[model samples]
Target: MSSDIAQPTTATGHARQYGDRALQTLLSANRALLRAEQVNALYQEMCRIIVETGGYAMAWIGIARHDPGRSVDAVAHYGDRDGYLRDLRISWADVANGRGPTGTAIRTESVQINHDFECNPRMEPWRERARSHGYRSSLSIPLRDERAVFGALTLYAREPDAFDGAELELLNQLAEDLSHGVRHLRLRQEHAHNARLLRRSLFATIEALTVALEKKDPFTAGHQRRVSRLSARIARELGVSDFDIEGIRIAAQLHDVGMIQVPSELLVKTGPLTPDDYDLIRRHARAGFDILEPIDFPWPVAEMVHQHHERIDGGGYPRGLRGERILLGARIIAVADTAVAMNTAKPYRETPGPDATLQALRDGRGTAYDPAVVDACLHLLRDLREAA
Candidate 1:
């Protein structure tokens, strides 16, 4: 691509113009790094800024591969309107093709400037390709990680000696900043991957505990699972974010964890529970909180479990939190748990069925249950019925 800028009449004017482009490129590079979220995005933006903002004819980024061929993979480019790199094949090995600006820059871990791509003997391999693309000069800057150079940012200019001392200084600084951006983004990506792995492990452990509890109490065998499913659905209908929905689902699955501390006989008893027995069962919420409070969860899992039994009217649970004071996840779980429990059959009572469960939620909306959660749950149940 042509530089497409007015040609300066004097040598002084030329140098001044070059300096301005370099400064603009550096500023744009800084902004790109701050806004960039991934390494590939950074590479693509760097090339684009160098071409459009710096007034380079063409620009591209190539990663040096350590495979058998030691090939340079052209990962990102701009201003290649003619597809200049379409059939490009280059390497970093000590071979003929590897002696070009991009390969040499990576090999030497320094900047490589081909002042005159037409006359330079080292440009023999790519000379024709360069001429065909109207590239008179080129600059290649090595991109490095914490350890060593891993890639090259190559730029082509319409004028010979386009990259002079002042411009070269700024371009070199841009390359350094680009390298740092790449390293930072890669580390962030790796950290996110590790965090996901750890979260999965934690979920597995929670699932095991839930399974053990279910095994101990046959009456509530699949109650937690049903609650988890309904809670997640209600959260989605309420437009809760994916991250918060995951937390709600997990909390709902483990909300009954406190019952493990209660006597198995009391849990399985078909007879009416005495007031003391009822109070003991009420203690399960706090017990579940204590069981989960020590674990380092990314979400408010312990608090959600503790507040699952809470009511919006400040009439329920250990703390009696009112209105918005109750955690949203817990509020969602409360609606789901109540609905699932009423619908599911128990040894001590007959199943109330879905119609009765919906009526119960409608009756308690706003006073006992969160109005919005009840609305979302009502919509979800309607959809389920329609789908059925």
Candidate 2:
């Protein structure tokens, strides 16, 4: 028999050709779906394809909140940059549930189009925004997984009736592929967030242990708490993000963790320390770093502990690190530690008030600390004292 079989009759051959093309399109879309690891990039590519091939003027991806009843938020957009900027500010408040084309598509879990928004009752509320941006027609397709609607993809055009039957069919298929990709992306993000939460929880437990150790020494019972407050305040003044501030605060609480290894009598001694006792006391910073190094913290807690004793002029601590080599977090902790230690009543000395503490930091600025961090600390101390 010949390796090539005879061609089928006309009708059968046409059906077979159509089936082959559909399979090829699906395979191409599946390849694109694998790039969904970066959702923003995937959405941008989807919008580009729609606008270039399907004649859309603008494209947007709005993701539904986990609560099915709530309206969606626009997570990505691609189009005429100026036009999108003008009309993209519509919040959930402006999109009535099951009313506008986008909302209706999401609610019905299907693709929808408004060829003339001016006459479409469902799109009336959003017509003005679209009209102002020169949009005459639009298509809204719901993105879904097996369970239910995940969100909607909206395409806008300057000309009315821009999306004909062929364009609509292509967009519908694209929306289905995008839905699966988006669902996968969401699951990955959720997993990453949960892992971060677990790491933070373990870090918190370590901080609590340090706090417990501090409490054992009556003189420093609340020392860690005060230092943490001061460090967080300084971080805020420096415009650090909330995430970094949380890390800095937790690290501050455990900065003196190595002190636990020192004898209790040495920690509470009223008189000046002897050579041997002083050497033991100085070892706490490195000891603290060693203790924290084994734990998997969400941030660089071990490095922060190690550098907390370092100074700006290369005169401080076990390694004598200077300048920017030290982490900003450690520098901030150093300033807070110094201020709190000076202001609080130690076993050997009386406590200075906030004013004296601020003056002490100012005197040591640049030599003992980072000037910017010290200035921020001084400002924070003044504000906190006034508030108190």
Output the number of the TM-score-best candidate.
Answer: 1
Question: TM-score for every candidate vs. truth?
Answer: 0.81, 0.56
What is the per-residue lDDT of model 2 for residues 1-388, given as tens digits with 9 covering 90 to 100? 0101112222333444434433454455567788667777787777766665444588888877745356577777777676554433332333454466666677667677776666566666677877888897787888887788877888887766554444456567778888778778878988988988887787678668766677767888777778888899899999999999988988888888888888888889999768998789889899989999998776898889888999989998879999999999999999999888876778877877777777878888999899999999777666545312
Task: Tell me the spans in candidate 1 whose CA falls farther than 4 Å from its real position.
Answer: 1-12, 81-88, 232-245, 263-265, 274-280, 310-328, 353-388
* CA lDDT, every model vs. true structure: 0.88, 0.75
Q: Give the TM-score of candidate 2.
A: 0.56
- Number of the top lDDT candidate: 1
| Model 2: per-residue Cα lDDT at residue 88 | 38
**Candidate 1 local lDDT, 1-388, one digit each (tens):** 1121223232656887898899999999999999999898889999899988999999999999999989999999999999989987889988887988888889888788787766777777777888998998888999999899999999999888787767878998999999999999999999999998998899898989899899889888888988899999999998899999998999999999999999988988887888998899999999999999999987899999999999999999999999899999999999988888887767677888778888899999989999999998888787433211
Error of 2 at 127 (Å): 35
